[model samples]
Target: MMFKTDKQTLTDLNVLDWNSASLLRFFDHTLTLGGRDQLYNYLMHPLTTIEEIVERQETIAYLSTVNVSKLFDKYMMVDLERYLNKPAAPSVKNRTSYFLDTISFNFFSLSAQREQLLVRQSVREIAMLFTALQDIVAEAKSSGKAVGLLRIYADFFSANASVFDKEEMRQVGRGKSWRLTTHKYNYLFRGKRRPQVQELFNMIYTLDALTAVAKMWNEGGLCFPRVNTNDTAAALLRIEGLYNLALDNPVKNDIHIPSAQNIWFLTGANMTGKSTLLKSIGICIHLAHVGFPVPAQSMETILFKGLMTSINLLDNIGSGYSHFYAEVMRLKTMGEIMTVDNPVVIMLDEIFKGTNYQDAYEATLNFINSISGIESSLFFVSTHITDLGEIVGMDSCVALKHLETKADPKQGAIFTYKLLDGIATEKLGMWFLNRESVFETFRAVQPRKSSS
Candidate 1:
């Protein structure tokens, strides 16, 4: 029951790439290697259960309410990870080796001092982090919500509060000299205390990742989606005020696909926001599955097994796949996936665009005909083939919709970016070409007939 999505779908949704337009880039606020890795892990694999998703959302919500800015020093935690990952010589407790090690330390005083400082920094950060964990626990208890993750960390902290509260640690930061602080940390971290330090480091990594999620949720004013996992097959998706998170002033629109209608046939002229709408839906599904707040005023949808999208298809030069062949292969892959029993949400933009109009129209119509019967999943297909809507609209399972546009005569076409029922019959392509004087330019570039 693992929540799944492919690399192509991720790219289509603009999720993971480091480009400024990626969804991950917009939400990533991690300051350490561990935190960044953790965030990436979550994005790659979303939780599959209702309870886990809600628990995670509650944990993020509670965290967003608290300002734990001083809990962990970003630089110190990064250096701590670096030090821990650094290769180390195996300890040799024999008397001969001990004496040799002591002599080696004398020769490498500068290196020893640097190592001591690293250890001191680690101890200070861990201590501050432990205190921060306790504060979160208090907040969780006060919130009266089921903050399962935070409570687990709080319990672990409570069980080991003694080691952190020890007199040696109390003197760690109070000492005036770096050598003295380092010696105290070294003494306190010996034996069982070493494992305690490791556990605290792990907690810091988890908290940092959570903190990044919470910060984004708060800043974006994102709301937790009402995920309906009860219907495992053919569930509905209703999102109000949905918009692209990457855009500065995006036009929000509502979308709804009742259980009776699973396939959405969207039609609109270019720049009418059809692709953006598809992307927004995909992003919302992904973020909701990740247990983070979504970029919408409200969202309620069925828990899909996975999301599959084909928006940005490209030719495979190395594989010798033409653009049309590549698109066909991608659709073939989706067809194969649909055969499986698990439910999935499928999205395709301008399918079969690489081929001629006759073939593209026929192929797209056949494709819609084949998938319209799938009752265990949802389908969203955006295309300029408005005729397909007429044919597909006859099906009870298909919903025909369009993003409407208006011609301003003087200002040209004014795009509303609003979703509406019924198919689009507007033929604005020629209008746009005429407005741009494309035919005049072509005429000017032609050879003169007078020469003949």
Candidate 2:
């Protein structure tokens, strides 16, 4: 993830903008609320699909907003399915079943073949039992009778409750011809498939675990981890402050940072808060969605999975890799984790800042197009490249405000660092032109490449 550009606060949100002052407190709050070890699963959930690099950047920017130690309570669809004990997408069924098998096997004492069969059988029995119970429920409801738990089980099968009909639910399975049950027949052969008297015990146990898993999801996602943030209210308040900024700032030409979604193609003068704006919005969102207060006195938003970045990883000692090459690889890695359907907050600072103009422009174009379709928490990017802004269409731009500077024509160019309206035509940083003599400097002499 790219770091933030903090001109004001030196806290943790300023990794270009992480303000560390309230960082620990923020994490403590998350931990307090999200529960134990749930943080690990929360972090890994985003890896399910990184649709593009741009979302990854925004994702990082969003991360700078939250307390890592504290847990955010938002749940993704897949997580919801798992928690509800519904099937995940068909693409992931085999994996889910494998995981289920492992859990069931480890928690029980069956041999490998036995384990597989037992799970299958249990699932079949459960399904049959479900249908039978439904039928019984209907009959009782239609008649003048109201069936209690035990009475229903006893009515459906001979073996039911003196206390509760719970045991009877299992006994009915013994009467079911294994050959007739196609759904869970394997389980019977896998384990002891005799008609046990305490059928309700097994039924209740399996049903309870299954139901709990849907609420909690797997060992990780099925259920929410505990939240342990030390101070939820304080962290929420800081978040509120950013909302205040968002509500306060309205237009780029006028410079009000409005609510926006993923992969923004930003271009502006150096001091326009392009970078700072990115963090401000990021902080605001992290605060608002996590149920913390926003920067603004009032806040509004939907919760997100997590945040990621690809902004500052650029300042490597010449990248030790080709600019376009590295950019491509980084984006590929990001796409693996960023999902288009879910929200990811990304921030890119002068992406391709190291590549030739042509390649940089092309890469940026592709990046923007890729994430334009995904939902997001925030997407902030900064650049001096005008074509990117123009080609992208500024009116549709997310963070396109410029830092309009007034030149003191008489006393050299003094930078105010104050942001202004409209896109900037000239950034005063030009004086540093020859800082790294790119043969654009004195002498048309090309760097002498050695001949073999």
Candidate 3:
């Protein structure tokens, strides 16, 4: 009974992909307590054989307590500040300065320290300068609406801002709402708007000069999810007892690809998932590197600049370009995209399928050679060309793996579709075609003893 129960549990778990089941480790963090459900799905997908993490809505909502709510508010405010300081979309300089000003309001409203600094200096100075009308600036300062009051001062300065850097305009921008003083204080000391106002105005004038720099943050770039390396991840797909789809009773496992550094050259019989395996690794690597939990049971992969594919190469439609020319252009473009900081993970299905055998192999060799030296880049190319592994592995720059095919009497020719080291074990399509009786006459003739 215990054995049956355990078998049932494994059966239930096997319903999830091997990779997906493996990622059972990422969720054990104090931080995940807030974004509980989302975090759970994110972490659980990589650590264990669980596919239905999203259906656990009840689990997530239960964790959102009042204390958690408060923590979320703190997180948002902190993130707001971090956003202002860090680079972000629309990458504009003045816009970013504006974002800093926007963030300053959050600080001012939440903390006494910020409020005092924001309005005190300018309010005291303004009151002293306009002794008879000091109460207006002082009241504005005392009220917990300093940001709005600063806007009013900015507007007033705009109206009288001659030469763009006039004292009135500069003070509003630099001291903002802080340079104000009371009528009582100003009555004892006399001056025309004050010399410090001119200095403050000068300081604010530079803010526009920085508008260009601020734009960089405003123009957003690529955004991707973050994956924790220490977290367990799931697989998108796996096969067991396995043809590509897997078998009913097979060795249940979480086969983890080890610290594989070099590019894997997958060669196999005609129908094997040499290409499928290539695509699987390509897609999973992309998703994982960008910080999304993969469709695997678990994953541990290095983050890279981007994943590129030469699989869907389309021929150029005539700006005077041949098929080979178009392919070369595409390969060249892929090569050019890789630079020092922004590296690439490229997938090349076949080096050159457009030309004759010798030329195709030669092109394939050179392409791999050119791309192999970069430490940050990886390329996987699938081929029916037998000598490809020999050509590429000779350089020690390529790693080799192949798929296996089996002849199941009931299933006929079945591809196990397993990833194995060394060259492919069979020439699948050739052998199957020979068995079909379609070549019966050809086999019967058998070159009948040399025509003497």
Find the candidate with the highest lDDT and give its number: 1
C-alpha local distance difference test of each model = 0.78, 0.41, 0.43
Better of 1 and 2 by lDDT: 1
- Candidate 2 weakest lDDT stretch, 10 residues: 221-230
Error of 2 at 412 (Å): 5.1
- Structure candidate 1, residue pairs in collision: none
- Please rank every candidate by TM-score, starting with the best: 1, 3, 2
- Score candidate 3 by lDDT: 0.43
lDDT of each residue in 81-103, candidate 2, tens digit only: 23224232123233345345545
Return the TM-score for candidate 1, rounded to 2 decimals.
0.88
Off by over 4 Å in 3: 1-260, 318-321, 408-412, 435-452
For candidate 3, the 10 contiguous residues with the lowest summed lDDT are: 1-10
TM-score of predicted structure 3: 0.43
TM-score for each model? 0.88, 0.40, 0.43
As for TM-score, the candidate ahead, 1 or 2, is 1
lDDT of 3 by residue, 1-452 (tens): 00011111122223223343332222222232223333333322332112122112112222221122212222432332332233322232443343344345455465745544433443443333332112332343465332322334444544534423334433443444332322211211122333433333322222211111122212322112223222332321222221112223322222233223356576877667655565555545533432333334444444345556666555667677776786787676666666533434566665577778999878777776776655645667777777877777776656777777777878777766666777775666766776777688677775767676
Ranking 2 against 3 by TM-score, winner: 3
Off by over 4 Å in 2: 1-22, 25-263, 294-297, 314-326, 373-377, 394-399, 409-421, 432-452
